[model samples]
Target: MRNILILLTAASIAACNQSSSTMNEYKWPADVKPPIAGKEPKEFIAHGDKRIDEYYWLNQREDQKVLDYLKAENTYLDTMMSGTSNLREKLYTEMKSRIKEKDESVPYKDNGYWYYSRYEEGKQYPIFCRKKETLDAPEEIMLDQNKMAEGFKYYSIGGTAVSDNNELLAFTVDSVSRRLYGLQIKNLVTGVIYPETITNVEDNDIAWAADNKTIFYVKKDITTLLGYQVWRHELGTDPAKDVLVFEEKDNRYYIGVYRTKSKKYVGIYSNMNQVSSEFRLLEANHPAGEFTIFEPRKENFQYSIEHFNNKFYVLTDWEAPNFRLMETPEASTAKENWKEVLPHRKDVYISGMVVFKNHLVLSEMKDALNQLRVINQTDHKDYYIPFSETVFAAFQNVNPDYNTNILRFSYTSMTTPRSIYDFNMDTQQRELKKQQEVLGGFKQEDYTAERLWATARDGAKVPLSLVYKKGLKKDGSNPLLLYAYGSYGYSVAPGFNSNIISLLDRGFVYAIAHVRGGQEMGRQWYDQGHLFNKKNTFYDFIDCGEYLIKEQYTSTAHLYANGGSAGGLLMGGIVNFRPDLWHGVVADVPFVDVLTTMSDPSIPLTTGEYKEWGNPADSAEYFYMRSYSPYDNVEKKAYPNMLITTGLHDSQVQYFEPAKWVARLRELNTSNNKLLFKINMDVGHGGASGRFDYLKDKAWQYAFFLALEGKLE
Candidate 1:
């Protein structure tokens, strides 16, 4: 392999219950032992670097020993958590009690029907229903997931679309939790199912053409699992005869298909990892017509389109890092003809938009808080909906009708419940539609949320969103759990979650670090934390932990770190960099083997993520990834207590990554502190599918933390 110095110059450097069980109740029998995976070294050579992976054999999912090992780990986890069985049950019950047994979502009018979903008293799934003409009309049951999921142990209903005539329903379902949903059509009036089934397609990329019988769906790449092909299938015909509408040949882009809000055009969009995108449009009335490119793809140019009248409104980052709004004639859809409608600002980020007849609602993020800006296009005036909370998330909700005076949006915070509201864009009046019901005496006044800033090593200020019970003291004695997911420019909203009530009630401070890897602070924040500058994510998180301690919010003895997936990678980095800062760490399905995983193109997300986490084939990226990858940096010294969890069939972060990390940690760690590993046999990346079943896993996790604190009573 060649050295990186030759090409380095051109690259831009972006930037729960506890339970104290009765000692006998929770303790595992001393005879039972932890699983120790046997190693057969495999040489991985990349960028002229050779690394020996002893646990590479664990990746062989079909091997009996691998299955036995995963099962053994599960057994060990159960035995270890047995002492906290009572606490786990109590936590589960408390969490479940807070959720309303029977709940219904707010109905939003779309086309001619008011659509919504509701749950029965004890069902794990929801029943999708709709009312025609008015809310008082008879309710029609489109699909009851409770019935479709009766036989499958794991099932999920993804995106759903109704034809223009409202006679047929197109939906996707995943039975194995791998995200490969099969498309099925249902006749609403006849109450019959179409025989044709489309398999191996994406869950959220389904669109119905105006013809009602023609549908466009995205096909997932069998090997990479990337949505790369858009196919059109005619109802009643075999899926084998589906015509390929478009295929994204670029390895860097992912494909998606959807209908415009006007329902006038079906669009196919190819989004590059992060920097660019290309969109194609086809009139909905002409299902068999070719899709014309809205704008040719250009490097570092990202834009999204929405059709309105005779023009296309675009949100692009052409010359603005924070993004701006542009409009172009529908017939002359090209970058050269695009005219600026809303210029970008340095302080505010245009996150999203929802177009209406006379107004345009933009979801903006400013000062780390979401602001809903309602722009009256007719009057050329705009105003923001006010929010009282210091740390909260607000975004446009379901507003399907393109012609409406009401703008539906949602708002929530750590203490506040998820509430939906309808605001009259013309009258400037807001009406509360529905607020989430939290049973078991949950009160927003009992808790408080605040925002803090942590100064990073580079002098950059990273925002931290925190929430805790009122009347708590800043004495450095409180136990705190710092969490974050600083990757893919995905911001972790400070949203409400009823389950967290248990922790707040027990005097725990939950904090989310708005690290550089996320878009919380803007595109620059994300750019500074990715690729060669990836270490900023880890450093930002560590700084937040340190700031919490310095301000007396928590102490090193009572501090805990929690993160999953990429955030799990943060946990791994922090524990390796500053082991003494945390008492315990919970890494859920972590991506710890960065260099090795990125080097393998066969992995699910490796190929498309080359731009995000530089391709390891390049020596510069290879050395940089190895420098911080958790598995490669396991040191022969004391480490913090840790509980690592993974699922056998995870498509995102392969289960073997965490398994191998744990095995290596067991071999090198010099600490006697607790180290546990668990693998869910029946589920994938997201864990249990059932509503209550998912809480059981959480109950077990909470019990682990409580046990560490000696608070399990």
Candidate 2:
């Protein structure tokens, strides 16, 4: 379970006066003291194999020793990096300068109101507002997040849904950053809060039924934190009184609730990792009625349905690896009743679909590029919304209304700002609604984006998307940072990021390895990189780095690597396999302790990922996982300079994984190159909550790269 709809400040702290310490100057390979984790050996024996974990005590988060060790690590990191304070501030300022302080998202219409979110000059939170009927109407503040977040160090607002009459509003909030949210309501007309509250529900996942008073939301597993049960609640009632409508018995499957676009049915979706899925439907008009299965779940079956024109349009991988579209009458819900609407293509992957009154929009990924196609339902004339860039990402934007012929979508590339457009399907014309405002005179022409291919050991061509300053030479004189997240079939799109401009302008080349384990190259690509074939992911990344060096993009001395979460896992894998290839590495909340974590079923995502990473209880999976698990495979050898980060409250990839990892590396690593650890005591998986503050971490990381290159001034 990777969250699909998962959605950080700087300067003054970096300038804080440094306190005197034993280490007078920052030195690489210096005789410095690192925190030594206590050796409380824990024996793990399975499948006739035995191992001892010396740092296993770090997982006891509630113990005082663990907290003290983490704090000590932070202190050590700050001391080691004290010399680069100025560079950090300079980088932070430069990165922050590109952003527009006062910005508002494009307003979208839903029901009778036009809604949007805007940020003030220096505010860290968004002000959600809406106007009735027309844009000229007076702004009604739906949620003043700035005021609500006044005293909280970390805060987030989850999904917000308004009543049918547009009077009552519901939203979820999280102050601890653990993904557990508190549900609350407000009377939009009266500007008053409700008395009812729900605790420990999943983040922002609620569906309002037609009754306006009843809503459906999913409850998380108390210990594991996975959304396993769907609950129905009525307005003004105690959450304890809420009815449990559905509970997914299989731990491998996760449950979620959402209302259909046509507003006719409320759908409850239960899915396994890209393998099998089942959806149940309840008539929105009859919220109290029991939901019925659209079609029974079958082995290897995967389908997502959208209601349109008295029919259910299904996008499924049943007998079609790339997925195809089939339609069935709303009243008859069975695979036998399906009629092919769009035939499957081996080369094209239908990522998603949206149905309109007169048109149907398909988000197709071909050659690692997203393409938007609009089909006229009545005339059967289909055409693509043309894009100008050869390497860009284009997908549907916020489209709430189902009756419009104009399709709203967003397009962006490594060089282009995020551009929103409204395409008229009837007239075959596109109107630019808005483009992200990059203040301080930014231009797309200053950068270049290119796609390259690297041959893996097995001769499989791996795609790489790269961007750099215009006229960048292939000579190995520039600094290059290679990044990848080769897991869970997640496609990392080559989208624009204003912060990256700092690197490009500073003579750095950034490349993303579209390796296996991601769906960018279609289903087969992902299949080959996971489970028993997982080694392909690490091998492909290493080969890509080798390819870049062979082509003179940059030498190993100037090369760095980065990845967060599962991508952090990539960072771990690559470093373990080819430590000499990278000069520096940033592993953000890395899942380095894969073998041990997967051996337990109580961890948040471990059980559900059995299909993704095979169940280690089996002898073969255990042996295979142990062979490559980063922490398990860490050797007593010279390693790259590394900065490992973690969050105290991270639900996914617990902080201990990295904490224990740093401890073991410190004990055995033969290199004196920096091995720094920093833990955000307040936040979770997604770091700092503010927009500007998030950039501070990136600035520090870039500053680290500069320092490693001996260019810090």
Candidate 3:
């Protein structure tokens, strides 16, 4: 490996001509060259297929050569984007001004307390607080995360639980940005944190038993980062003496433990490949009792359980593709003994359910939109909470009481701020508790949002949600940004983003493409977008971009694309499929080396996601993945301007994936378009931990787009 410092110094002198009056006239000096990684060819032979991967040496995280390359890439990114430094700062300040710094969340009543979180004027983290039984009661500070995170560069608080006696608080903290949390118990009354800390536990896996002294949590596999072991710990006892309550032997399944909303049972759930799941239950009162299987696991069968009034409600996809609801007595816990509560509708996908004493709430998806259905358990009558916007998102909020008629949920659209509401199931009335406050005189009336459908090559209608400033002309000259995440059955909702207002105010249209790999249109949508049919996801996004161009919303010269993680994979795919469709692209923590990563089970999500991306061990699946893999398919062609970002500590998609991808793209690309990579040394998959700090990354991304569009005023 060459000394990067010497090369960078030489390139800096050669690229000194940075006096362009407009961003569109800027160009890289012919003598200046980006850092070139050495090719160490590694051959992977599987199923009689031979593939040689260069830049494979970049995966050596401990090697100084690999570190030098990554640092050089970061330096190159800084050098290339130096001209936009002022614009980036301006954009950052513009976006940050819209946020209300000293804000508090709407309090929700739970376990005889009104719980909420609040942020101080200049704090990066929130303070967890609660009031006893009434809104007007004296506030009790549960946890001051800003104080706890004072010395850490990256910090996050995961699941938190108050003991049954309300004297102790169990919380998980992750300081390394790897999603491996450390469990700590705090004495709320004395304000003393216990000395015993359990390490390597999964986030959001902490549950308190009724005894209050005993709590259950899932431990992760150090290598794969899978939470496979459930353990029980007693207060004031050494964590080394904790008992292993359950261990999932299957590597394909991840497990977690939680207490039921009714407070009657503690359940451990095991989910496999997103296609099958099984549950085990133990009476909450019996902290020492053994768990009994709620139902044995079966292939392609998935069900979730909730308890209420001595009966267990089950949401299952047993014979329905979109899922249905069923119920059975607590004593007779078997699929055969279950009776239908709500038959599955072909058009409506039941995503989740909440059980209450007198009413049941179902969160459903129809026409790529969220719908909240409330049903009276006594009268068996149901009604949906109506939303006027054609493209909006609604989700059930915290309703821990299980005995109240009031259902709390959140609603938001592209043009609307996120608002919390309390809806009465009995009276069919709704009360607005609070809406997110956008500072700097923000007004919803100044913006407009609409839904559009694009026709794919196979005649599939892909939904697109777009928002822009009012009185915008439908001209082909406008700049538009398209985003999507079409994988893992995760739907990209048309939610509100106050940060996007900066782009809207700058005459840029922001849109979300609800492509096929997501569950936006139900299970069938996901089924068609993954595995052998994964290319459909990329095609759908391309079609949406073309549709916008055809409708005079934007043209290829002014179109931009952005996606993160799996959506980053989408960005990689689309750029390969149709490089000329985008003027600029931003891929954050992308998974681009698909065939190689899928073939290695040691990777974090490889084995568990075989069903989503086909198992490459099979010969047929190998060829299919290779057909569209961004890294494998990189050819000698002109490529779009790209900004690739990654975190060195990212656990979901290894940082090496994008590092290797940038090297390969630069090697094969024949165009002079900007190809830059930025690596965050302190963060993970989710960028910076601080609330306001993340906006800097967003501002940098927006600056990239604005610079390309010549809007860098």
Candidate 4:
């Protein structure tokens, strides 16, 4: 509320699509619609801010009337932030005290170090990383400061990926050039760090090849978001060993790569957001053909694949409305390229492939919950691993030593804390390596998890997960915080967060609205909510909110909504479409300007998102997207109190979108509840780099939700 001042730029948003849709040089309106997944955009137009602002502001008489009406309503800033913060502070303090009741000693390492990052309030260096844990927590120092003083600002360490041989460690660094980052490789044995080796490359995504001979990274020209290419670099090849790899002939397409069972393939998924994807595969060996383009099931369908259990497994809806996988023998790209390992079904999706020794683990998507399916690739027998209704999202890289026998995976959900566990591929014996426990002495028994359902306007069922204290009654009188992310075909996986403990301990229930635009309910579920059909997200969230109150999980007076980025669009649409449904809303780094944001060619994410958000100016699809553009739909009413925060460095959802949305909301709302904006100046789309800072913001956000639910005050 106090510090941030919008710097040099204060322009309206632009709209466009991915795949050279951005590079094609198109004129944009001063305003645009929200981003939705659909066909490539084909038109051009400009919007006047005055047109929409007049309904909320510009016209003093009408604006003042709306403002006066909202002035007397119970809003978030006055009720939720004030009340919830108090309850959370009390609950968090109580939980921390209980945990501290014992001076538990965690194993410390020698020459071993646990490193973390830091950002000072007003120093010349805005960001730095500190070494801790292995040694007693010491004075935090800048990460790789390396004696450079003036103008050597804006550097932070991205997460690291170690080579299989442990010889090289490739990481990314953000120098803030147009707010893009570069991938640099370092010899772990030699202590030789390659800073700026892949200089000025856009995006922080980088991966190391299995042979360790090459490191692959993504590069996008600063001038054009659509001009993106994936490149590979071999050490000692040149000053940076930078060698051009596969540069897409079509600037509209983008590629994603992942490793599967003894083999690695760069998945050439999609160029734009048009819902179509297929990939060309590259093997380390094979002179006759180093890479083979896999036959696509359909031109209209897009997909992603994972290699596990000696089989080529992928998620696609080619065979049916829902996405299943066609997997073949892992090493035998020799004969047939891909075979239907799992035939498609119209009802569900199969994801998260984890190959343990000779066995495979998969997460099956059936409407709401993710079911675990483990099978022996050779014997073709079901392991029937039951998880007591817990959603097993996906399995990450397993530890090497147990690759042949035991399988390790990390799983989380709304109610459970994120936990890392290892299981035997044969006996299914499980050991818990880590459970993000309450910091001091908090107990898991204090919380309970449940599945709830709400039917959408189209008679579609939305499954939701709720986590809260064990003894809470069914009367729904408890304060509620509902969350959702209904875009990108990405299913919101159930995982645990320690912060949820703070809320559960305070009698607050956290609910996840498993809505459309996500693969949670399978491919058809996603299709039902994308691009022109995007309004399904709002209707889904509203249904979830109304269901909560109807079930007595929470009163309408105590209901709150929260989402960030794509999900932020969800929060925006909900309050705008159904204002009386919520007490408070937190839309973090939201893309509210939708159609206009997509139209902007200069914005980092527009071109790439066109497939997701229809190009409003050029296509009939734009009319569908126009129906849900929130910025253009705000009504003169007592809207819920809101908090919109973003990072100045965020490229995905530009800071201007939230800033302008707030500016408009201030004029439109009749309520006097404070609308707060917190900007993390030195970070990107996700906000801060450090885990502690993220938790701080998380607490602040939930505190805001509590204030809205009437608990904090």
TM-scores for every candidate against the unseen true structure: 0.96, 0.96, 0.98, 0.76
lDDT by residue for model 3 over 491-532, one digit each (tens)? Answer: 988999999988898899999999998888989999899999
Ranking according to lDDT, highest score first: 3, 2, 1, 4
Candidate 4 residue-wise lDDT, 1-713, digit = tens: 11222211112221221111233321222232212111222233444222333222211213443223222121222232332434446554544443322221222121234333333422322333333444456634333433332353345555455565656667766655244565667776676776446665544456566677566666766655443666677765663546565566554455554343354554434444535666666664321234455654344675566555455666565655565666656566432466666777767576556655577677677756666677786797876555664544445434433246666666666555666676676887888766655566656677777777798888998989888888898786787889999998777766666666666766778888889888887877777788778888889999989988988999877788899899999988998888888878889889887866666666676766766777756656566666677776666777887778876667777665775576567656887655666656566577654333455566667666654444442
Lowest-sum lDDT 10-residue window in model 1: 1-10
In angstroms, give how far residue 31 of model 2 lies from its true place: 3.4
Would you list the C-alpha lDDT of every candidate in the order shown? 0.87, 0.88, 0.90, 0.61
> Clash pairs of candidate 1?
15-528, 19-712, 20-712, 20-713, 26-82, 26-83
Among these predictions, the greatest lDDT belongs to 3
Clashing pairs in 2: 8-690, 8-693, 8-694, 9-692, 9-693, 9-694, 159-204
- The better-scoring model by lDDT among 2 and 3 is 3
Candidate 4, after superposition: displacement of residue 606 in Å?
Answer: 1.4
Error (Å) of candidate 2 at residue 299 is 2.7
The regions of model 3 sitting more than 4 angstroms off are 1-6, 10-31
Candidate 1 per-residue lDDT, tens place, 255-331, comes to 89999999899999988866889999999999999999999899899999888888989999999999999999989
Worst 10 residues of 3 by lDDT: 1-10
Worst 10 residues of 2 by lDDT: 1-10
lDDT at position 557, candidate 3: 96
